[model samples]
Target chain A: MTSRRAFLQRSGLIGLGFVAADALATSERLLAAVPGLDPGDPEVPNEEVARILKDLFGDRPIRKGHLTLDMPVVAEDGRIVPVIIESDLPMTPEHYVKAVHLIVDHNPDPHLAAYHLTPAIGSVAIQTRIKMKRTTWVRAIVDTSGGDVWAAYAHVNVSLNGCG
Target chain B: MAIGEARIRIPDRITRGDLITVNAIVMHPMDTGFFRTAEGKPIPAFFIRDVVVTYGGEQVARFEWTSGVSKDPVVSFTLKADKEAPLAITWTDTKGGVYRQTADIAFTAA
Candidate 1:
């Protein structure tokens, strides 16, 4: 009969093996999506968000106009704050909104989400619920495939932090 | 049984030029890995990372999200409908789980 201690030892080793394998597989898929994403780092800091945006958009100034962002001014729970973004920019083959980068200023990972849009949609509007670490500014930066960037910002007051 | 339940909402009928809102919600834990359970074990992070919406075989919205999104996320987007077609919504979690749902849409006059 196998001793209890021996069984525990074998199970512990098997658990470790499974964890290591899972990490390896996850990193491989994440690398393909975010090349610079670090395997050791689970979340990107606020400073990292700025760097990522700068790298993606270059030095172009993102003007705040022609975009509408809707979100409640106050949220009782920061865990599920509804947000909506609408762009008046025309969607055409020559000129269209390429993507929308949603960033929360105070979240542990400020780079909250991103959405890629196409002209086939005939419109550029997206809505999603995001979690906030605290009361912060959620900004949406819209990239118009034509070397122009537009942004819209909304402040959400959270009574309770969500990312703890 | 699947780990999540996904539902997609599309308008019953809309004008050709009208913008219709499509909403999708998936029930998920969205654990951020920063919290420790009562047993002191940190829950592994799990969340839906990619959301793809396709209409009439044309991809419209592609969203990438992380654990920063809330539990049971609600994703809504609008598209101008020129013709009636089927809409496909798919959500891919971090663990390679894919949940997909399709809806047939028909448009009416303005």
Candidate 2:
């Protein structure tokens, strides 16, 4: 354990190592709580969004429509670009939105965030801010409990790099 | 201000079965580790990795985030105000820092 810690420190990933360790433990607990779901790697950064989606969905068809992705056409400050996502999908116990994944195609890490939701949320409405490394396409993908995937995209021109 | 400090907001007036919006903001650097300091030292990645929201003792939403989120993140979502219960938001960061805050959802007669 000490050797691993030392190696992580030397690799400039000491922070990630600590977080990954905790996240792994938590994911294990969550796995038991929610079966048949793969919690993707939270430690790695800059992974391709397509690869991440493929890993999660496994070639499932992602259809377009049924959702709205809103963002500024041009962001003078990429550090905090406001984004809002809403879906017209029903949120009933029989069928609901299982998750919403946010992706930035040009960021160092394209897979920005994922929100796992329940029917108790009443609606598939989300408003958040994100960092953009540069001008990119932001995609919001929704997974429904009924085994359907819907997606929407918005293009944003960023004047500054938010990653720095 | 301390790291992990958070604030939660809910509608002032809620009715039974009303779909209400909940907002939360947490203070953190959300450092991406891709930048460097003036001395050219590489900044390590340090940011919130997980966020959970619970209402009436049940999990309503969970968010997994990467460094792509802006610093001092703000997240908003909608919840069904079916019961008057405590709505809690918790944020856990890369450095083992956990911050939490809760707001009560009081409902009026519809």
Candidate 3:
């Protein structure tokens, strides 16, 4: 019969193995979607952001107009920073916003979220809260069903680290 | 608040063709796994990864999120009052936890 201490040690090792495997799986999934993603590299956030944008928009030019990104100029608490995005662009059957991508330039994971929308949404107004690791630029990229992309960004000074 | 508990808010009065806003907040820790406890043990990452909004049996919006979302995440969006139907919001977490909330959009004659 196996000793109790030996069994506990073995189980702990197995648990650590599972945790490592789960982390690997997550990075693999992200790498598959964004080939340039290097989750471990500290200097890759900007590159990763650009790579993700390229992956989504290809060689299409991203216009700087039509999107309004609103967030606090200085976030006293980095853990919960409110963000609001509004666009004057029309939302009709023929012309509508297809997706809105949120990105934080310096976060460990720069790609915060991607919101896919339909014309039935009626407008391009969205509000959410995000965590910022440090002072960084928060970007809002809007893609229209017609293949055009508009981008805007807001600079936020974070007083505390939120990713811990 | 419980991990799966959610609160959704919508206008009580609605008219056909008028745009309405829906706001939802869910209780979640959104742990990023990068933090360590007092004993120096790493915290495991657990967060909601996907959220879907459907109206009248049709999908209107879908959100794919990472660990950067805040704890007790809140999301708001606008939708057209095209018909009187059930609006549903579904949240799916990384550990296979799925939480859902639905609210009926009853239209009042303009």
Best DockQ goes to which candidate? 3
Ranking by DockQ: 3, 2, 1
- Candidate 1 segments whose C-alpha is farther than 4 A from its true place: A1-46
Candidate 1 global TM-score: 0.78
Off by over 4 Å in 2: A1-47
**Which residue pairs in candidate 3 collide?**
none
The candidate maximizing TM-score is 3
Residue B25 error, candidate 1, Å: 1.0
Candidate 2 clashing pairs, residues 3+ apart or interchain? none
Q: Put down candidate 3 lDDT per residue, B3-54, tens digits, no spaces.
A: 9899889999999888999999999999998998899999899999999999
Residue-level lDDT of model 2, residues B31-105, one tens digit each, is 999989999999999999999999988999999999989999999999999888999998999999999999998
**Candidate 1 residue-wise lDDT, A31-137, digit = tens:** 43444333443333344565666676667666678898899899888888888899889998899998988888778778888888888767777878888877777
Q: Which of the CAPRI classes, incorrect, acceptable, medium or high, describes model 1?
A: acceptable
Error of 1 at B59 (Å): 1.6
C-alpha lDDT score of every prediction, in listed order: 0.80, 0.85, 0.88
List TM-score (chain A only) for every prediction.
Answer: 0.70, 0.70, 0.72
Candidate 3's displacement at residue B44, Å, is 0.7
- lDDT of predicted model 1: 0.80
